[model samples]
Target: MVAAALSAETTRAALFLAATVGNVLGALVNYALGRFAIRFEDRRWFPVSPLARQKAETLFARYGQPVLLFSWLPIVGDPLTLAAGLLRTPLTVFLAYVTIGKAGRYAALLWLMPS
Candidate 1:
């Protein structure tokens, strides 16, 4: 979606700003979902095993802020952000990492695509 938008006749500044804003919004939504909507106790919805959550918690504890860098990975990325939010990870730190990760990911995608 972002790539398509950037490729349009829109001004470069506008495209860049849109992409950045979209990425941040996506991360924030993921964080909110994990923090409020999904419940660990609610097996029907979350369905993730206790062991998995424990592992994720341990990874987050060990990695601290850098874990946010992996927030782009398929399957794992969204959950990681959500877990970070649920764990009460500092908002500033989380946003910083998420922004960097998302920016880098989009930048790479933009770079790789044919002009």
Candidate 2:
């Protein structure tokens, strides 16, 4: 959808803004879902494992919040966004980092598409 919009003669800045807003809103929804999952964290059906939890903790401790820049990544991206909510990342910080990452991803996709 974003690629189609960008290819329709929309200004790059406008497309970027729109894509960023929509993508960030979607991620925020995911974050809210994650926050809700806190109620079920101890259930047997919960998805995370001990090893994965340890790794995520270590990475956050070692790398700090800058690791959020890679939230645009595919398989790992959604989980990272969820983790941000699970860890209660500040709203301003989450918005800034996630927007940067998502905007960069959309910009790259637009750039690589044949003009």
**Can you write out model 1's per-residue Cα lDDT over 1-93, one digit (the tens) per residue?**
555655686754566567877878887876776677665545666534455556667778888879889877766676677778778878888
Where model 1 places Cα greater than 4 Å from the true spot, the runs are 2-7, 11-13, 40-55
Worst 10 residues of 2 by lDDT: 48-57
TM-score computed on alpha carbons, candidate 1: 0.73
**Per-prediction CA RMSD (Å):** 3.1, 3.4
Number of residue pairs clashing in candidate 2, backbone atoms closer than 3 angstroms, sequence gap of 3 or more or interchain: 0
Q: Each candidate's lDDT (Cα)?
A: 0.72, 0.73
Clashing pairs in 2: none
RMSD of 1: 3.1
Q: What is the lDDT of residue 6 in candidate 2?
A: 47
Clashing pairs in 1: none
Q: How would you encode candidate 2's per-residue C-alpha lDDT over 4-97 as one tens digit per residue?
A: 6646877766877888899899778756656777576567865555455556556666787777787777655666666777788887898899
